[model samples]
Every structure is written in structure tokens, then in C-alpha cells.
Target: MISLANSAARRSLRTVSQVRTLSSGIDIDVDHYSSGWNIDDIGEFTAKTGKYQIKTFNKISEKGLARFNPEKFEIMGSDWDSTNANAILLRSHKLQESEIDVSVRAIARCGAGTNNVPVARCSELGIPVFNTPGANANAVKELVLCGMLLGSRRIVDGVNHMKDLGAQGLAKERVEKDKSMFGGQEIKGKTLAVIGLGHIGASTARDAAALGMDIVGYDPGLSIDSALKLPNEIDLTDSIASAVANADYISINIPYIKGENGTHGIIGKNVISSFKPNAVLLNFARGELVDSEAMKEFLDNGDGRYVSDFPDDLLWDHKNAVILPHLGASTEEAEDAAAAMAADTISDYLQTGTIVNSVNFPAVSLPARPDGAIRMSVINKNQPGVLASITDVFAKAKLNIVQQINQSRGDVAYNVLDIDPTANHEAISMKDLQKELTMTDGVLSSRVVFGTPGCGYARNIDGQYWV
Candidate 1:
């Protein structure tokens, strides 16, 4: 079972402001961030969706809430109604199986992991999930340094040992006599194996190199941007086994992709057996990435230690386990950046049908359509002729296609169409058109909207709920 922090239960749906005009308004529900981010920018951009309303929870950042233009949109208190909420902006609050709302067209998480949000269920519901991937890179990188230091040196043990002395009579003498027991090697000149050279991994390698630690890294999924961010001195490893075998310390920075062929127990028997006898293993990633049974067996047989932010029952209270509360992305700056990014991405999706950092859908962003043009967004099963069938409905309605784009992610596909009836504007009825599009086989959800160029929000009132 996956367990989150105690703060996860504080489920809050925050910020929404409604416009007084008769135009269709999008209701954006804001929630509490761990450190409370500045999302006034989100409110401002979302206002482009003609008349819009923002509903915020009591825990919303005061500075962010104040950014909303009070003259344009109605701001309500915590008792505000959210039945019409178009989206959810959140941080750590978990959206479990039965809690997923049908009205929410999308969910934008302030941080990287979507574990708190049921991503698979969102995909099934055809609701996009957005996350700020590198927004907390620096915060996690610094924490990696902290974990490495704690693992290599007996700093925590030393501090605990000193605290036990209590400055009693002759305490200084007692401390001086027992200091050697807490002694461990310094990090300088030690080899550090960094698995998953993504944002956090690359940053950690660069900083660790500056501190004189030799860096060995491996990441099959490393992007070009991440590769450019790495220090030139790092030795690129051919495999995890090779990297772990050669390092004095190992840092696992990969995300947990559940059920991937080699994911579950990625740091299993082979890697654990090859570790330097007294080496330190750090897992700031996910708990399921490491095989707890193998880790327990390894630690029981040697002087090695394991440091992890996500600890299961096997690692809890173990002599060599240095378990930490998941504090990698807990810094104030990280929280603010993540929340701001998440808000911006979500606003972009709602106003323009452009998805940038969506976890469930492939990234797609199109140029703004001309004024008075209608737009259609369809989420359907990934299969042949799904696009043609959607376009056929538009063609039969005698709509001129201004621009169209289609993208697929795994088993689902998202299509966007910009239509202009030109002289036949009276012939195209949006209400009837949406009905026809939704009736198409393989179509999960469809929305038809018209207004200013970036003023239309996709309203999915008939979204399928997956429990």
C-alpha cells in the first residue's frame, strides 16, 4: 500500500471567480498547496475565457487570491458552491478511486508525482492530468545532497549520540571518549552512482561533482535538455549494475512507472549484491522501485545503510535504514514554482485546448483560431478512423475546417478542430453538433465551444466517471 504524508488528508478545492456577463464562464477550483503558491497569474489568464469564476478554498495563499480582479469575476468564501467546477488545481491532496469528480475536465498537480492523483482513472475518464516536472528540481537536488551526507558520514548518529550526553557532569569527557564510534568517511573523493539522470538526478550530479564526488550516471529516458544540464565530468554508465558496482554511494532518482517490465524492484538482488560492502544506498524516488526484502537482506549481512524518503514496513525501524519523511519537494520556493507552473499549464488547456505538461495526454499546442471561429475537442479511444469519423460529423454539418490537430498517448487520443461556417453560421447548431459528436463510437467525450480566440473553455458535462 502507498502511504502519503499526514498533510495529504487536507482535501481542499480553492479559487473560482464568476463573471457577471451572460457569456459561458469557466469555473476553476483552486486548492491548497503544501507551501501555498502564488496563482494570481492563473486567475488572470483564465479570465481570458470571457466571463470566468474562481472558487478558492480557505487554505489558498492570500497573495494569490488577491491577484484575481474583483471587478471582473465574483470571488466567494469557503462556503462557495463547486458543483460546476471545470477543473481542480492541487498539490498533495490525494484524489482516490471514488473521489474523482466528473465535472473536472482536468487536474493540474503542483508537483511531479501524480501518485496522489489517480492518473490511470483520469485517463479512463478522458480527463487530462498535468504536472510541473522540473519546477522542484533544485529543492530535490539539495535534499539528495543531504541524504548523501547523512549516509556517508555518521552525522545523524553523531548528533543523536551527542544529545544523549546531555551536558551532565563530565559530559564533555564522555563525548570526547565516544566520538570515534560515530566516525564515518567524508563524501569528498567518493564515487556516487546516480540512476535516472532526469531533472533532480542531473542537478545532483552537477553539485556533487563541485564537491569533489566522482559521478557515474545512467538514464535510458534522459532527455536532450537533461543531458545538456549534466556536468562534463560525469562518467556515463552503460547499465545500473555497472554503476552500482563501482560506486561508494547510489542515488535512485527515477519515478515509479508501475508495472513496467524492469521497474518493480529495479534495485533488486543483482544491484544490491554488487554494492560496495559498506556502501550507502539512497532512494529519493519511489518506495516500490526498490525490493524491500532484498534491501533488508543486504543490510542484515553488511555494514551498508539505506536512506529513503519512501519507506515501507520492511525498511521501518531496521538498523541500517535511514527513513525520511518525503521532504524532497517541500521547500518554499519549490512549492511556489510548482504551483505557478501547474496553474499556468491548466489555464492554457482550458482557454485554448493546448496541453503542455499533461501526464495522461500527449503534449499538443496549436496557434490561436481566428475570432468568431468555433472549436471542438474530442477524447476518444486510440484506433483507426476515429479522427475521420469525428471530421465526418463536422463535414456533414457543412463546417469549414480552419485548423485541426490530433495526438495520442497510450490507449487514448485527443483531437482538436477549429471550424468556421463562414456564410453558413446559422446552419451549424453547437448544441446538436455536440450531441452528434458524443454519439460517435470510441468517443469518450466531446465539447463544442465558440467565443473569442482564447475565450472558450471545454465543458464536459457528460464525462464518464471511472471508479
Candidate 2:
């Protein structure tokens, strides 16, 4: 709950490259060189920690930079270098293979859509990437309403047509005469089909319902909690075809992850063919969710109007398209909320071995250890004997387990353990323990965190503490 707005001007945002290795431990890379906006909550969280180092490029926001006290945390200003960055606090900037250093342990994006992040590659590297899902739900919901309004009224085209009318004598008369040509229908009585009922999708459905729009949603993976939270009037449809076929407008809110039964082009030929003629399609989600070429064909056929938050080369400036610069989660409040959540999530994981919102690994939050205890978090391939190997290593080292929690998702499993590190117990080398786990058959990554909730250093013991 630390506020950075009070002292934003004290820290200037400029392009510079520098490196400062504090403890060769947890060095965080703050995306300052991307010319993207930063949030103060992340800096405030880091500042309060007083344990880690944060490296920044030019993109670091004034408030975010201002909150960093040298005495509390090490802050490095750099020009686009992430070589020594172990953890990354990122926003819109893309995290490609070249930009990622082997030192990176985790990457936390400030917003929900992780399309800007290379999630699959990170998973392969056994690095858990995180996102703030519902933190910006309100922001995206408001924008979806805007999109609905824009589609129903044809405001984008109408405004352009109005601007084209020169300010000559009798221009007002001409506008009045031509106004009816741009007139469109209202959304109150219309049906809106929402796909992928995640946080933003469900929020959009509820808000649109309050505006008198009938909601029809389709999401095979919708959780029971999310389902219960949805408005009662919303009719949950069984299939995408059913949702898209009967609606006057459709919103694609699903993630664009490509895998086994993947959503690479979920809104392609089948969904488009079944849509009601003149149905408006709103996609505030990833651009890849809908196939650009297929969507353009549908738009060119004059069957429906397409509005996208993410515009690609194929659909840019199309007469039937209203393209936005990915503003779904761009509000000031959303930026702060998401950044704060991401910072807090990463801080919790690094300091206390807690995984809350990781995309690759299962969420595991264990109770805080006592005064003197050693904590460890392990991410390994989900297979037999992995946990046994981990515990056996601890047993061999004579480390007493104080408390532990374990969870698994698909192919990966997450383990958090707090051990008694008293002088009377055997002196266990965290490095040797990590090496043992890494050498095990299915083990992917292992980390040992020293200290408790208020202070700790998460280090990879396979090699140097930083790596």
C-alpha cells in the first residue's frame, strides 16, 4: 500500500546503461529502455524490501524510479541491458530469447495478456512467468463497453465522415443532411456473445448486462468461482458456435496460447461463418486469437464490423475495422493495480517461496517460517519420484522439514518447503542440495531462499547465487 505518486518528480526518466551487482543474488531488471510507461507500485514494493537489486533502462516511470531508496534496495540505471537481471518487471515490452539472460529466474508482467512475454520458452527454461489477471478487470470492461458503443453506433466511421465535411458555409446544414447515412442501432436490446469468461470477460458480461444487453458466454475452462460470480441473466452456452451464431455482437476474450487443442485461431472459419450478418466482433484480447486473414475476409464480405484492441498489418485501417492501439488495460488505475500485484507476487515468491499467479507453475502459498528457518521452492517435471528425490536430499542433509506445500499443473509441479536451520542441526549447503535436485531425472529448476517474510534472498545454487 505504498504510494509513489507523492514523489514522482524526484526520479528522472532518461536513457542510460549501468550495472551494479549488490550481492550477486536477486537482481531485478526493470524495463526502462522500452519507452513504455512504468508503475510506482512496483518500485514501492522493491523499495520496501531492502533485500534485492533492481536494474532499469529508460522506460522506468518517474514515480517508480523515485520510490527506490539506495539504502533499501540497489537500483541500476541502464540502456536496455538485462544480462545480470535475475527477475524482470515488464509491461508492454517484448521478452524475446535474445533479451533474456540465463540469469533470469522469473518474469512478471504488469498486465493480464502475456502475449508480450514468451511464456512457452520460459516454461521450457523452467522459469515461472507471472501476470496480474483480474487487477485490470474494470479497465478492460470499460473499454469493451466503449467498443460495443463504437460498433453499435458506427462512431469510428461516423466521426471520420463528419471530420471530412469541411467547415464551409452551410456545413452544419450538410452535416444534418448526411447524419442519417451514418446512423446505427442501439445495444440495449442486442445480444452480446462473450468468449473465454476469465476475469475481464466476466466483468464485461456483467457490465454489459447492467446496460440491458443480453449476455451469452462460452468458455469451456470457466472455473466454478468465476461461473458463480457471473450475472444470473447471462445464458451460458455449450459451444462457441452457439454463442457466436445468435449474437448481434461478439467479444473474443480468450488467451492466445498455442498447444494441444490450442486456441491459435479459435475464431476462424467456423465461428465467422455462423455469425449473424452485420454482427460486430470485438477483440480486445490477443491479435492471434482471431486469424487476421479470415477476419479480413469476413469484414470484406460486409457481414460484420470488426473492432480490435490489437491491430496487425493485415487488418490495419480497413474500412470495416476499428483498430485500437491495445488499450484494453491501459488506464492509470489498471497500471497501478497490475504493477502492484505483479511486484507483490514476485516479492512473495523471491522472499518467501510463494507462487500465486504463475502461468507455468501451480500456485502454492505456505505459512511463513519461524525466526530461524531455510526455505526452498522447486519446479520440476511432473513425474514419479520427483518429490521423493527432493525430500530424500533434505533427509540426507539432516534438514528437518518445518512445513511444506506441493501442487502440480499438467506437466510441472511446484514444491515449497520450510526447514529448521538451527545450529544444532546438520549444516546443509543449499548449493549442494540444489545441485542434487537439478541432477535428478525430472527436476527442472530449484531455488533456495534465505530468511523470512520481511527479508530474504532467492538464489539459484546450481552455479553462482545470481544465476
Candidate 3:
């Protein structure tokens, strides 16, 4: 009878282990830093896709998408809307490989540059960087034109007056400023100067033309052929000043950068002072592209009507200037597109490591683990015996190690360990493991995660739904 009971107990344990392994599909990383989306959206693609174990924030040490099964899973980009996504990928991560297959749709953060994301990092890591550059070009370009027209026409004044407490203030001012400012100048048939012919600039020029505004494009990067599609009466100038000098309204579409020579003040104080008296200035680009103080002084004291969407102190606190909290691509269409595109990228990376928009690492397509064990990503000192220390903790816990991957960062080591525990133990119970890791002389930080395939990221969309 005792022998029979032992046999039954062994079978039960095996069944539990099998269920745990069978339940292994993909582990999506959940955190506040990520936009809400997960691998569950790509269920039809991976039929053999394992059980998805929900991973916690502190469990994974690799930031952004690196925590997603770093070993077997290769994160990369692809034409998500076109491809059969049998893999998972992530957005907002640096891809580390080259000559990779990808499905990527990337739109910049409304006039943002590939500037902050270095190409060398992607090239060295063997990853390809492709962007959906013109994806939302029309939408943003239209907004820029609208901003310019409004700046020229002072439409913000109308919007502001409705919010004001003074009765009849708007009615009184509308009749007064319309004929008063610039002797009643309208945006129609006026010059619209654009500083960049990149995606947004391209859009701005095209749309501004429709509104009967003459376009003046000044970009050192754009060729004459590309500039030809601009307004028929538009002017193309080599100098930045040539664009600003003859404009009834100015739009700075340059990417934002910090530092003295970092294009922070491309529209310098000197350039601003040279503007036509009462010339309208609008910046729908990065905040650092223009000189905030000079612009404030120019608008507040000079003869100009300033309207912008940037969050500069001068723009927000001043009356003439209109400030928006970086809502260029905040439209429902843009948000939905971004969310879907980012999701597809993350899902692809999770399954195949095909990193399309990654800043580092090559794009790859592979599983995180073969045996379907819990994936733990650790970022720590790369010194000798660090791996031994981590493995020993699992050894002490009497867990079975299935696979381990360690990527070195200079002197630090990022380790991904897949393990089978002896019993049901919450990975967070590894506080002792965390303490032991922090206590290690060389260990920087330790984390654990469930490996799905792509970037593991999450947020409470409906809020309180996770409960």
C-alpha cells in the first residue's frame, strides 16, 4: 500500500510539471514605461506558441524589450501589416543584429529625429534600422499648416477668448485685432517659410500651398527635385535666413537637440530680431530647435504674433504665444496607428528577435527557450564567478536549470536564466535572491521574468483591470 501511494504521488508531481511546461507560451513584460499592448494580439500567428507567463516589473533586468526571452527569442522589425507574424517584436528598443527579417512601421515623435538614436549602434550590433517615415506625414503636416495659418490669423485668440471670464471681451478684441495687427494681414497669398523639408516639413509645404499660402522651403538636406513639388510660386533658398526673411509666417520644423552647437538655437536671437515687424512665428517642432528666451523677448517686446505648440516657459506664460503640451500626434488616428505598429514590432521581436527599429542589437527570430521554463533576465557585474553565484542560488533552491544566456556590457553581464523550480514558488519570493545578488560584490542588479517572444511591456489601459 505504501509503495502504491508513492507511485501516485510521483505521477501527480510529473503531471504538475507537465502542466507548468505546457502552459508556457510567451511572457509579455508589463510596466509603466511601455504603451499598453502585449503578445496576446498575435495569437493566430504562432499556433505552437507556448503558454504565456505574465512577468512582473522587478523580475526582468533588461530594460525596454531586452527582458523578453533574450536567448532563443530574436526581436526584430517587419512589415507587420503585411507579414504572417509567427514571432513577437517590440518597439522603443535598440536592435542588435544586421541582415535581419523585420516588420516595422515607425513614425517619429512629431518632428523627432533619428538623431538621438545612433545608427552606429544598430550597425555594430548587426541590426537594420528602417522607419515608416512618411506614415503620418499628411496629418502632422496639416497640423503644422493649421498652426501657421492660425498664427498668421490669430485663431488662438478666438479659442482663448471663449475661455476668458470677461464678457464681450472676445467680441470686442476680434473686431479690434483683425484690422489692427499688421494692418489686417491674412494668411492667404502670404509667405509661409519652412525651415526643414523632412517628413513634417514636406507635409507642411504641401498643405500650406492648399490654403493659398506661398511656401518657402530652406533645407540643406533636400534636393531641388524634392523641393520642386513645393508651391508653384514657392521659393527655395540655400540660406536659412532666405526662408525667414520674406515670410509673413515662419514655421521651424527642425528636430530638437540640446547643447550650444547642438542645433538648440538654430533660430538664433539674431535671426529672430531680423524678422519683419509683426511677422508670425510658429514652432511645431522640438523645443530645443529655437531660442526660448530670444523668442520670448521677441514676442513680448517686439512687433510679432507668436503661436506655438511647444512647452517653452515664454510660450506658456505669455499672452500672444499659444502653447500645447506636445500633442502633435495625439490624434486618435495617430495613437491607434502608433499603438498597433508598436504592438506588431514587439510581438515580432518576442518570437523571432527581428528588431526593426532597435537602437542596438541585431534582429533575430528564435524561441526564448525550448523546454518552456521561467525566463529570468539579470543585469549585473561581468566579473568572474557572477554566473556561478546566480546559478548557485538556483542550486540552493534545488531548481533545474534548462538554459542560461549572458550578454556582457563592458564590465557588466546581463544573464537570462531559464529554470524549473522544485515546487510552486512565486518568483518574487526571490527577495532573498535579490538581496543575495545586491550583496554580491560584483553583482549590479538581479531580475527574473517569464519569457514570451517580443518586448514585454504593459500598462493599465482600463485601470484596475489587472486585479
Q: Which candidate leads in lDDT?
A: 1
Over 353-413, each residue of candidate 2 has an lDDT whose tens digit, in order, gives: 7888898788886787765565677777788988998898877767678888889887778
Query: What TM-scores do the predictions have?
Result: 0.81, 0.79, 0.51
User: Which parts of model 1 have CA positions greater than 4 angstroms off?
Assistant: 1-81, 167-170, 260-262, 425-427, 452-467
Instruction: Write candidate 3's Cα lDDT for 1-467 as tens digits.
Output: 01122322222210001122235332222221111122223333222123222221111113333434444444334433212222223323433222121211121221124553344433322223333344455666667766766665556665555456246556555655543432335778888888888767866887778878888888887856557666666678888777788788888877665666667788878888768777888777777777878887888776587666667765786766777776676565554454344444544534433344433333333346645465555445557887888778777766677866665534445565666653434332343443454455555433334433322321111111110
Q: What is the lDDT of every predicted structure here?
A: 0.70, 0.69, 0.51
Instruction: Give the candidates in order of lDDT, highest first.
Output: 1, 2, 3
Count the clashes in each prediction. 13, 11, 68
Model 2: lDDT to the true structure = 0.69
